[model samples]
Target: MLELLSFGDQGWGDEMLLAGLMTILVSLSSVCLGLLIGVILASFKLSKSRILKLIAEVYTTVVRGVPELLVIYLLFFGGSSAVMYFAKMFGYDGYIELNAFTIGTFAVGAISGAYSTEVIRGAILAVPKGQFEVGETLGMSKFQMNLRIIFPQVARLALPGIGNVWQITLKDTSLISVTALVEIMRQAKVAAASEHEPFVFYTTAIVLYLLITTGSNKFFNRAEKKFSKGFVIEEST
Candidate 1:
């Protein structure tokens, strides 16, 4: 068993390690993109414009309602075609090919963004109306009020939900194997098949995932505590 895992030409450790790094990179990129998309969608939902709200609602509904694997398949197979079609309108007829990593990141990010939208929207709504009124009484503009008063509270409230979304995003990278990205799960499968020892490689993949998720949980926990300080006051007896 150790021989198969040794870090040399005689083993698969280097390949597995590189795959683990790819998994982390994919997860981080997807989660960050998801957060950006989430903020946009949440803002749309909160806007007074009915059309904007409808757009946001439809995006979240469709993405969340569809199976994740199906979403990945659609993006993997059609994304480049969609891009090329748009490019042709500008008289650029060359093929636009998206790499596996790009497709996988976008596919997973869209999924994560759908969930994050609800969490962020709810967090915004959870803020007290009193705060807005106070900002108005102080003669603050809407932009100033949102920037100074509302944004912090919303971030603090949304962190926990965002952490959950991060975990989901991390696991979702496994599905990206179909796109031919050599992330942890893909490397494990390859190793297992090559060595005819599925158990060993699969277990290695699990350990790698657990290490990442566990570290993520700890980081979020500390962040929550830090952000909550002073904002959370003890009730008087």
Candidate 2:
């Protein structure tokens, strides 16, 4: 049993490790893109414009309401047609091919973004309004206020929620298997089928996922501690 997982062609260990790396890379890319999407959506949701708010609402509602696997499938199967349609408008008629990796990244990012949107918006709202009022009273520009006071507080408050989003993003990458991206889960499936060792491969995959999540948890905990050190309120006797 151990020989099956040994390195090189005789074993699937190297391939499994490579697939694990791919999984981490895809998850990281999705999380980064998701954070960007979240920031934009949160801004829209908090904006004064009714149209922006409506758009944000619809996006979050749809993404969050749908099962993540369906989202990945839709992006994988429908993405090419959608891209080709836009390409035709710009004098390009040929098919616009989107690889499985791109589709997986995008689908996971969109789902992660919906959750992140709420986290960021809540963080923004959690900031005391008086901080902004004080900034204005002191004649500080909006940019300065956001930089010096608002964003820092938001980051600190949003850390835990962002960590949750990261965890979701990591797990959601598994759904990308439908797109044939060959990440950890897909790799495990292949190895299991080939070696007739479903239990071993599947258990290995589970352990790898736990390692990633556990490491992420520690990282986020440290980040939360770092950000939480911003202000100190001392009592006078």
TM-score of each: 0.93, 0.93
Question: What pairs collide in candidate 1?
Answer: none
- Model 1: lDDT equals 0.93
Lowest lDDT sum, 10 consecutive residues, model 1, at 227-236
What local lDDT does model 2 show for residue 206?
A: 96
**Reference-based lDDT, residue 219, model 1:** 98
How do the residues 157-213 of candidate 2 rate in per-residue lDDT, one tens digit apiece? 899899999999999999898788999999999999998999999998998899899
Q: Please give, for residues 1-237, the per-residue lDDT of candidate 1 as tens digits.
A: 988888989999889989999999999999888989999999999999999999999999999999999999999999999989989998998978999999999999999999999999999999999999999999999999999999989999899899999999999999999998999999999999999999999999998999999999999989988998877633559
- Cα lDDT of model 2 overall? 0.92
- Considering summed lDDT, which 10 consecutive residues are worst modelled in model 2? 227-236
**Most accurate candidate by lDDT:** 1
